[model samples]
Target: MQTQDRTNVSSVEAAIAASQNYLLSIQYPDGYWWVELESNVTMMAEVVLLHKVWGTDKTRPLHKAETYLRREQRSHGGWELFYGDGGNLSTSVEAYMALKLLGVPETDRAMKNARDFILERGGISKTRIFTKFHLALIGCYSWRGIPSIPPWIMLLPESFPFTIYEMSSWARSSTVPLLIVFDRKPVFITDPAITLDELYAEGAGNVKFELPRSSDWTDLFVILDDAFKLAENLNLVPFRQEGLKAAEKWVLERQEETGDWGGIIPAMLNSLLGLRCLDYDVADPIVERGLQALDRFAIETEDTYRMQPCVSPVWDTALVMRSLVDSGMTPNHPALVRGGEWLLDKQILDYGDWAVKNKQGKPGAWAFEFVNRFYPDVDDSAVVVMALNGVQLPNEKLKQAAIARTVAWIATMQCQGGGWAAFDLNNNADWLNLLPYADLKAMIDPNTADVTARVLEMLGSGNLSIDNHSLSRALDYLKNEQEPEGCWFGRWGVNYIYGTSGVLAALSLVAPQSHGNNIDRGAAWLVSCQNPDGGWGETCFSYDNPALKGQGNSTASQTAWAIIGLIAAGEGTGKFEKDAIDRGINYLLATQQSDGTWDEAYFTGTGFPGHFYLKYHLYQQHFPLTALGRYQAIFSK
Candidate 1:
């Protein structure tokens, strides 16, 4: 080998060794990776609201959460949906209300600033539906002014244009109990000083719920909401008691073994409050179990406590397993075996909400959370399959069975558009997004380029030919979805880099011959976006404005993603690509801490485009490890 090749190999080997040791050191004895899932101050504030409504004496925790919120407050005087984001109306409104309820006086300067920020953003009335619901619990906002989300919607037939099942699993879990809350209209017992009248742009009495413009389907939902309100006022609703009972039953049935509903905070909290409204005593087993489950989501430090949006053991463990294997770990390595066994235990054999839209598919996917059987996402399933496929276990039959089932299930989940969605199939009822209760913008689970690419990658890893019908359709979908600038939209990650990287990587593996020019275009786009510092980063702002794609401070995870994408596109064979990969690898090496992990404070995970984001603390470590390992395997030859 040339001296330059020898040096590159040595550098790659050293980086991989250090990163592998770090990853292994952090692995749990049971062989799963559970990283900190961080979101915004909204989680802490919502926890405060949860305790206040449940009448729990969580004084100390509430105080700590209040402190955390204050500490996180941006210099602009309001909280944001994600770290480093500008002040958000809903998050700011909720934080202000939570602090006030915790006895922070309105006269306090911080409180005054927050209040000013709220008013400047059109005040409390302009907050999202969930925020409005929380405010109404404390009597700060009139429940009537919020969009109607009657529990009666649950009684709609499956054939109906809109039903609970038509919503995304997270939305379904949250909305079921929320509908019950809407019915009971429970008020928070608090001192009069806790009211938010002072934060209102206009007097509280002037607040009104107005219909949306009649230019689109949102207007129809708005009209339906008004009609529901009229029905509610006249007590002319049909089967009201039966609807409540059915909603309650649905919530109870979906309660996870871990006591969480779908293993998400919004559903867990909503289910608890809904049960309380149904007159279930605080000591009731269901309520007690629910509270206990929620307690697990709390991440407490010496002086602060914050709530995670959700746990991600299944997702994290699977990705780590793949990274370890890619970094040269053997298939029968103990860590791989243990991790593979743990993942096999997590597969969902029973059907879930995804089955509602895709009845033809069998039950064999995995959920993102530890016990959210009702919502096994396609992204998690694909990655898990990839991880399991890399491991050689003692029980060969069990491993093969798991892989076959997962592959078949993923195939069944293909959308009509020749792609795949995260949770459900054929769930792209765009008109449903106009519903008054769809303020979170997650009502529909539509096919996305990132997820479809991941599915294609999984199929390729399993040795499915590009000529297969499913693979062929997926290729078509990706080709049609590629943007004018040679990128794709990342639905679950940050932005164009994520989407383009994912698509390029999958095409390189599954449809190399067909996607040669496509890969070239994607590779060129990635190279063009490289930052001056030799690393790549895309901001959360890209979700709102495509112009910001691939434009931000360099981050270890995004840089690694760009590197992996480029390598997959055969850029490693070119001088420019080789330099880019070396620089990106060097960036990872230089940024490594004494403990061997890379530091990443930026949010890369997306909860909702532009509205919510997440920071998976492990992404910085595992992704770079995977990228470096792949680099070594490709070019170290």
Candidate 2:
């Protein structure tokens, strides 16, 4: 028994070392790590349609994009928003249309299957509103079918109830330019041959377009939408001129020096479309720089090409740096110092959109992307501060200064219920979602368990405690949020396991002995959900069906999350918890590839819950390392 225990220790230590070396080797000289944030084919499908709209289809490597789209097609012939999910109507429409534009024949096997699948699901008319918007730009879909987003909203005073400032930061940035495009309703005529006429099931002329009436408020908004369209057809909008000017100016001014907007693809692509509507010369510097920025988001290889939903160098670096240090890398190692120093330089000292609501909060913290200065989110800011906690930097004062203001800034961002959101402070106007244009239901930044738990973890890692004045209410929030079965909801990750792990970790650090009950219940729930194979998993379907929580095929990241959660809940003393942790750690060890990475084909990251998902290419890399390192720290002691 003693020899076996010794072997286990040696194995854990060896796994940690291999992961550390692998991550260290990949660190850029300037000090950061990044990888693709894969979402779905629609991202690249839009890229194809965007170039075709602007007549630059020949300029980019469209063939490479075509290759990627074909590779992602499901066995049934349509595309999905994430892996292993059935075909999504909107995604399939976009991919089919894009493939046709790239000259795929209707008679081809791939095209026939996609067309059959789409038509079986009610054709293009059944697709989402966003896909309709993309089709409208190329004249394949009617502008009349598209929902109205009055540009006049841009001219409203900030104090008004419906001002742009009320929307979430990402929604606001992406929508302002869209307001201009919706008003102009421009259609750049595409090649006569490049039409989606055959994809419309009801025939393009006969399809009825309607907004979903999920509530009485939405029903009223749908009627109002008709009124707005009638007014639009009559050119009766009062502030159309002023509205256009304000929106155009807002879009241009918000473009970062790096030429991206909102640091995401939607904003970048829509800004390009907005510029086209305004008659900007294609060769203009702003247009050229924006083009270059979008080009940088694309990753091409010998056979396939794809675009990331967004880049995450700062987010990835902060997490990876912390994971490496936790794995026993020396605090002052060159990798840690360089990565820490690089993060210090990325701090946003100037005010951003969050400042509009959190006026008392000073600007300090980092954003997920390389240069999205206007939107530094609380989630990323918290993790980055925690990541820098013990790292030794040459300019120690600089690190302290950044963390202090960040801590202060994060404090002021607490919502009404003592929870934190990613971007805005108290951005919980749920009624805004009733608007027809908010079909995605992502207009408001509501406080979520995953984010609040992460915030608590950051607080617990520092001077704050459960009884601290700043966190007493937050602790209550977490306590009340626990489900009857003991798991918590993960609004930003896959269902229950992610939320439970984060909350248990926070409780382990911040809660006193009196709080052990909450920890035990959560830890027990996690133990009960373990798969027969000894790992843990959850499906995105849980967002749509609560009963499905903590059920799916196990993957590297989710299993690591469960292990980290159990350890945080004091697993070592309990036979059940200890065995569960042992099995999980062993699963990670057995599944890790020879290159010190794990292959995760399933997406553990969440975009908009059920509607969208993401597979962070590095989630398989950094998370397991953190799990193993933290486990060694506790049991090996």
Candidate 3:
């Protein structure tokens, strides 16, 4: 057993060496880099795109990831949020497709297992909305069962309650291809392994296909059993033609000259596929340019390589910059200037979906990336302001303008109660969560503690309006949201610890004069929540299980978030905070591979609080820097 363990460790080391070299080559010329973003459905798109681009999918990482994914298949043969978990229908459908592309035969054990699971889970008839739509495209399911995304919504003025602009940033980007697909009803591929007869509902054959109408329910989405009723009528000739033209034009115009939508595989694939259905030739410049752009997102790491769904240079750079400055890296260091420039170049100058949806004047808000014009998130905006304030930009006018615009944007986004939502103001209705078959708990509106706290603190410190009556109402909401024990629940991050730390940090920035009152209370709560191992960790599962509160093995990343929060709350050198920081740094130091990175199988960030977690490759590096920087800058003295 000892010898086998040694062999396994050697193999991992070899693979890591190769992967590191490959990663190094892929770094952007600008000194920072990004990989594709991914989720269950989009992951498959990346797999297919990678295979097509590279002409061979044989890589050490691909094999390892494939093995992990297959091993994670549930007893019935489907994959979930984590590998070897129970199936999420959409994710399972995508995974099954990926395996097939990888040459897994229908009779293969993994494939058979997945098929059986799909059958038992009410078959494709009961699949989630997006899953059913994709299956219908390939003839595995019927198009009639899917809801419609009307192009007419585009024509709706910005003032309308349910304008397409009101959809989540993610939803709007996703909705574009959906609108195209809905209008054309393009079912281009049919799988012999699965068919409509194998999955459709009984006695539902021969019903004419209809599209789902759009509705805005500011209330909450609650699950309902009845089938979605078709809208009373359709606008036949003129409206249908108008919708079709708009859909086609939208798809073509948004095709990045490079062919990727923010360099994501699914959006690129679906849009290109729709264009093909419209008779665009494969050799057309639109298609050719897209293919070239998609190729750039792939990284050939060590023994294997895969495409990242999108780049995250700005996001990673911003966080790392803070970590360095906080860690005691002098402000004059060249790294700070290079990183600050990258961030300065990332701010959105034009109005985005926020402008259309909220009818707010076009104020600057930083988005996740440059080209994602749909929704400029409030959290990113708040953090950008904080990051910008840390480094001095050479251009004085530009710096002042950025500060003023960011301040204005954040102040407007603050809810009537003083907190901020992720994407919009006054849009946190739970009704979106009740999309009958959708299992995502994160689809609801964002009161998101971390985001709200960050916004309050950023605006408050600078003589901004984050302290207005509306801002105070937000603070009251945060206070009430806090558990009697003093911890608040994190909506976009992990569990109670994330919320507790965020609230502490924001309250400190707001009430710094109170000097350790709210800060002390928040600090006490965090100290109490610290695990015996001295580092902080919270499982994504904690969202579903309050009893599992603060229950996770020690991790460097969460420990850093917690430690930073505590320090920001004025507890920098407190016993528990210091202990947590020391242990977390030690954990990171011990785990660092020779390549100056750490591999954590546990996902520390949340996209959907109860349903999905993100594996941020840079978190282990940047976060440790932040925590360590804080220790050096303050405690070392």
Q: What is the TM-score of each candidate against the true structure?
A: 0.96, 0.97, 0.79
The TM-score between candidate 3 and the true structure equals 0.79
| Model 1 misplaced stretches (Cα beyond 4 Å) | 1-7, 191-193, 209-217, 465-467, 571-576
Candidate achieving the largest lDDT:
2
Candidate order, TM-score descending: 2, 1, 3
lDDT (tens digit, per residue) of candidate 1 on 249-311: 999998877788988898888888889789898788888888888889998888788899999
- Arrange candidates, best lDDT first: 2, 1, 3
lDDT per residue (tens digit) for residues 1-637 in model 3: 4785455344434433443344444455674445444344345434553343333344324554455457556776677774323557666766676566555677788877777776677655555576666656656566665654555666666556665554555555556666666666665542223343433334246333433323645212321221222331343323555666776786776665446663345576666656655777657888667666655655654444455555566666666666555545566556566666676777777665566445665657776654555456787777767776777666647866887888877777766545678877666545555553244534445556778887776765455564467666767777767776767788766768778777876777675554345566677777777777667777777877888777787676777777777777664323345565555545555555666555666667677666665666777666655655554454544
Best-fitting candidate, measured by TM-score?
2
Judged by lDDT against the true structure, how good is candidate 3?
0.61
- Which has the better TM-score: candidate 2, or candidate 3? 2
**lDDT accuracy of residue 321 in candidate 1:** 89
* RMSD (Cα, Å) of model 2: 1.8
- C-alpha positional error of residue 175 in candidate 3 after TM-score superposition, expressed in Å: 1.7
RMSD of candidate 1 to true structure, Å: 2.1
**C-alpha lDDT values of all predictions:** 0.84, 0.86, 0.61
Clashing pairs in 2: none
